[model samples]
Each structure stands twice: as C-alpha cells, then as structure tokens.
Target: MSTATHTATRMATSTAGHALGDSLTMLRRNLKHALRYPSLTFAVVVTPVMMLLLFNYAYGSTLGAGIGGGHYIDYVTPGIVLMAATSGALVTAIGICTDMTEGIVNRFRTMAISRSAFLAGHVVGSVIQTMIGLVLVVGTALAMGFRPNAGPVEWLAAAGLLLFLTIALTWISAGIGLVAKTVESASNMPMPLQFLPFIGSAIVPTDSMPTALRWFAEYQPFTPMIETLRGLLLGTGIGTSAWIALAWCTALTLVGYFWSRSVFYRR
Candidate 1:
C-alpha cells in the first residue's frame, strides 16, 4: 500500500480500538455501580415477579378460563418477561441522568475517548442487567407452572428477541435520560413503557377489550412483540407480529440513538 493509504488505515484502526476500549471501560463502570447498589436491580426484578404472582393467582383462574382455562401462566409469562426487561431499563435512564448531573460526564468529555462511548456503555451494561432480570423472571414463571413448547431453536429465537427488545428500550431510556433536566424526571419518563404490557395482550386477550381500546391494544408495538414471544415460546403462529415487532424495535432504536446523540452533543 502507498504510505498515505497505510497511514490512513492505521489511523482508522487506532480510532476504532480506542472507541472499543473506552466503551468497555464505561460498561465496567456501570456494571460496578449496579453491583455496589443492587437494590435498584432487586426492585426492578421484584415488580415483574409480583405481577406474575398477582396475575397467576388473583386473576389467573378467571383470566385463564377465558383463554381455555389452564395455560394462563404460559400466556402471561412472555409478557412478564418483557415487563421485567422494561423495568430494568428504567434504571438506565436514572443512571444516565445521575451521571449527567454529577459533572462526571463533563470530566469524561475532556478526555480523548470516543464521544459515543459514554452512552454506549450504559446501553450495553443495561442490556446485560436486563437479561439477568429476564432470567430470574422466567425462572420464577417456570417454577410457578409456566410451561413452553419451545425447543432449542425456538428458545434461542426467544432469547434473541428479548435481547433486541432490551437494546431498543435501553436506547429509548437513554434518550429520555438525556432530555430530562433531573434524575427524578428521567426515572419518571419511562414509567409509561412499563405499563404498556397491561394495555396490550400481555396479561389478557386484546380482543376482549372495548372496540377502541382493543384496536389500540392490537396495533401497539408491545402487542406484536408479546405476540412474537408467545409464538416463539408456545408454538403459536407468529404471522405478521414478528415483522411488526422488528420494525418497531428498529425504528425506536434509530430514533432513540440519534436523539440521544443530538441531546448529548448539545449539552
């Protein structure tokens, strides 16, 4: 290669390396914080588990009868899994907001690190934390008689879908955090996302709702996602829900990513 070309290649490689290293450093920092103060994680995990129990016991008998009377826990487990991830993602917003407010981000800005690494760290670390919460929730569901017909391939697909959903939501949470003026506001911003499952097919059939509410529950992003997970794990037909869920995830991720970048650079 020509000298100039080789020099450019080396420079690009070095920049990529630095970016990766910086991102890893930030990820470690976030994970350490999660380990040190695990109450938040426990809180996130507990909400979904409690919901699972509440629905399975208080409402499961009545609700299960509506959907054939025996597999309500199976039907609701997918929704609770998503709920767990959503609950964990709320912490990403709070953590990001706290970091932004404490001037630590300003210090990072002064360093010769990747500009996106700070946010990327939170996103990656949050995904991992969310996955752990998902596992715990799923385990609890199984112990409570939630059974799935999924084989290895189907189980892997369910895992991939969950990870994609987590990443998409984490990005949105990060963006919300960036836009908020305070940590409290950031924590509150993603609250609506957690409740979305209730209005959708997560806990009950959307078809049973009133016309307008049913229409919304049928068309909303979470419905398709919950359907897709149900299809994967319980051998239900995915139909168009998989495509719709993918579209929602991709669109939300792109919007959240760009919005966060814009807000971050502006500040």
Candidate 2:
C-alpha cells in the first residue's frame, strides 16, 4: 500500500486502541469508587431485591395476567431488572458530572489521553456495573421461584438485549451529565427513565391502562423494551416490540452521543 494509506490505517488503529484503553482505565477508576463506597454498592445491589419482595408479596395479587404464562414475579422480574439498570445509571451520571465540575475533564484534556476515551470509559464501566447488578437481581429471582423458560441461547439473547439497553441509556445519561447546570439535576436525570417503565408494559399490561395514558405508554420506548425482554425471558417469539425497542435504542444513542460531543467540545 502507499505510504499515505498506511499512515491513515495506522492512525485509525491507534485511535481505536486508545479508545479501548481509556474505557478500561475508566472502568478501573469507577470500580475503585464502588469499592471505596461499599455501602453505595450494597444499596444499588440490594434495592431491586427489596423491590421484588415488596411488589411480589404486596401487589402481585392485584397484578393481571403474567406475560410469561407463569407467576407474576416470573413475568415482572425482567422488567424489574431493566428498571434497576436504568436507575443505577444515575450514579454513573453523577460521577461524570462531579468529575466535570472538579476540572477532572479539563486536566485530562491537557494530557495525551484520547479525547473521547474518558466518556467511553464511563459508558463501559456503567454497563459492566449494571450487568453485575442484573446478575444479582436474576439470582434473587431464581431463589424466589422466578423461572425462565428460555433455553441457553435465548437466555444469552435476553442478557445481550439488556446489556445493549444499558449501554444505550448510558449515552443519554452521559449527555445529561455533560449538560446539567448542577450536579443535583444530573444525578436526578435518571429518575424519569425509571418512571417510564411503570407507565408502560412493565408493571401491568398497557391495555389495562386508561385510554389516554395507554396511548402514551404503548408508544413509549420502555414499553417495547419491557415487552421485548419479557418475551425473551419467557421464551416467546421475537415480536414487533423487539424491532421497536431496537429503533428506540439506536435513536437515543445517536442523539445523545452527538449532543454530548457538542457540549463537551463547547466546554
């Protein structure tokens, strides 16, 4: 190949390598934060389990038909886990905003580090942490008799979907982190995301909701995600909801990523 072509190839490879490296470093830093604040980790890990018990025992009777043709808990566990992932991303955003406020990003900008590495790292770290939380929640469900009818491949597919959802939301959360005027608002940005599930097919069927609310709930992103996840875990067929979920995630990731880049450059 020509020297110019070779140079371009090398530069691309180096850029990709730097991005991956930054992600790893950020993951380590976040993991250290988690280790230092074990209480916080414990709270994030345990809160969903608590939710399961409270919802299942207290309100399970009031809930309608299980989407999975099983107990309500079995149907609701995946949604609860998705909710947990969404809620847990709040801390990740808070951390990013704190770093931004403290001039950590400025310091890194002065260094030889990759421009997008730090942001990429935060996203990667958050996804990993959310997956861990997911495992704990799933294990808790199994212990509580929440069985998945999905085979190994379907289980992997379901896990993959959750991971993608988590990563996609992380980008949106990062945008919130990057643009919030104060740390408080940045930290609370994920609150609305958590509530999305409640109005959707997460807690109850969207058809069961009031007509006005049902219209919004059925069209919202969370409904598709919850329905897709519920179908996978329940070993049901991949339906239109899965396509809708993918589209929503893709749109969110692109919009959030570009918005964040613009904000980051402006700062």
Candidate 3:
C-alpha cells in the first residue's frame, strides 16, 4: 500500500482501539454503579422471578397441561428468561437518561474519547448485567424443577441466542433513553418490550390463541426467539426458527444503533 494509504489504515485502527478501550472504561463505571446501588438490578430480577414462581406454582399445573400435558415450567422457562433479559434492558434506558440529565455526556464530549463510546458503553454494560441476571433467573427455574434436555452444545447455542437478543433489546432501550426527556419516561417507554412475551408464545402456545391474536403471535419478533430457545433447551426441533430469530435480532440491533447514534448526536 502507498504511504498515505498505510497511514490512513493505522489511524483507523488506532481509532477503533480507542473506541473499544473507552467503551470498556465506561462499562466498568456502569458496573460499579450497579454494584453500589444494586436496587435497580434487584428490581429487574424480581419481576421475572416472581412471574416464574407464580406461573409454575400457582398456574403451572393448568397451563402445563394446557400446553399438552407436559411440564409447564419447562415450556415457559425460555419465555421468562427472555422477559428477564428485556427487564434488564430497562436499566440501559434509565442509565442513559440519567447520564444525559446529569450532563455527563457533555462532560464526555469535552474529553478526547470516542464519540460512540458513551452509548456503546451503556449498551455493553447493560448486556453484561442482563446476562448475569439471566443466569440467576435460569438457576431459579432449575431449582423449581424446570428441567431442560439440552446437552452442552445445545446449552451453548441457547446462551448465544439469548446474548444476541439481549444486545438487540439493550440497543433499542438505549435509543429510547436518548429520546426520553426524563428518567421516568425512559422507564415507561420500554415497558412494551418487557411484556411482549405474553403476547407471544411465552405463557402458552400461539396455536391456542384466537385467530387474529394467533396470527400476530406467530409473526411477532418475540415468538420466534422464544420458540428457538425453547427448542434448543428442550431437545425439540428448531426447524427454521433460529434463522428467523437472528433476522429479528439483526434488524432490531441496526434500528436501535442508528436511532441512538442519530438522537445522541442531535442533542
């Protein structure tokens, strides 16, 4: 390559490294904040854990039988887990909004750090927090007799899928945070995402829903993810649902990323 081209490549490489390094620094800051003030993380874990117990103990028998006389807890574990992931996404929105309100982004702007690192840090940190919460949720489910037939490879695949879903939701939540004028509004904006599993195949099979609801349940973003996860965990057939779930994850990630970038820069 020419000297000018070589120099340009080196600059790009250095910039990318700085962005990654700065993002990790921000991640540590958020993680430390979560550790010191764990109320929000506890709150995020509580809802899904409560739902799992209520459904598995209070209504698992009926719902389990309704889903074809199998263990309801097994069928619903992935949905609840995904719900936990979505709940964690709320942290990103609130955290981003809090930082913006505190004028932290302005402070970040004055520093010589990468511009994208601000939001990227929140997204990465939130995904890590969410994944940790998911491990707790899964442990709870397992304790409650939510046995899955997934082998090591299957478990790995399921974790991979869950991570991708978490990333997508976190980005979307970050965007919502950027758009919200206040912390309260940011918290409320991501509510639909957290509860979307109910409208999908979370509690029961989509086949059991009424015609219109069933149609939507089959096509919505969450269903495919739930189904794919369920299949992997239960040793059932995944068919093409894995591809569909990835497609949704990709589209959602892109949308959230660009939206967040545009909104953050506009401010």
Best by lDDT: 3
lDDT of model number 3? 0.92
In model 2, the runs with Cα more than 4 Å from the true position are 64-70
Looking at candidate 1, the ten consecutive residues that score lowest on lDDT are 82-91
Decide which is better by lDDT, 1 or 2: 1
* Displacement of the residue 227 alpha carbon in candidate 3, Å: 0.8
Tell me each candidate's TM-score.
Answer: 0.98, 0.91, 0.96
Tell me each candidate's RMSD, in Å, in order: 0.9, 2.2, 1.2
The sequence of per-residue lDDT tens digits that candidate 3 reaches over residues 61-97 is 8898887887888998999999998998789999999
lDDT of 2 by residue, 1-267 (tens): 999999999999989998778768877888888778665456556877888898888878667344334488877787788888787668667878988998888888888887787887777777777788889888998998898888888788788888888888888888889987778988777788866788887777878778999999999888888888888888655579898988998898898789777888788
Off by over 4 Å in 1: none
Candidate rank order under lDDT: 3, 1, 2
Q: Higher lDDT: candidate 2 or 3?
A: 3
Reference-based lDDT, each prediction: 0.91, 0.81, 0.92
The order by descending TM-score is: 1, 3, 2
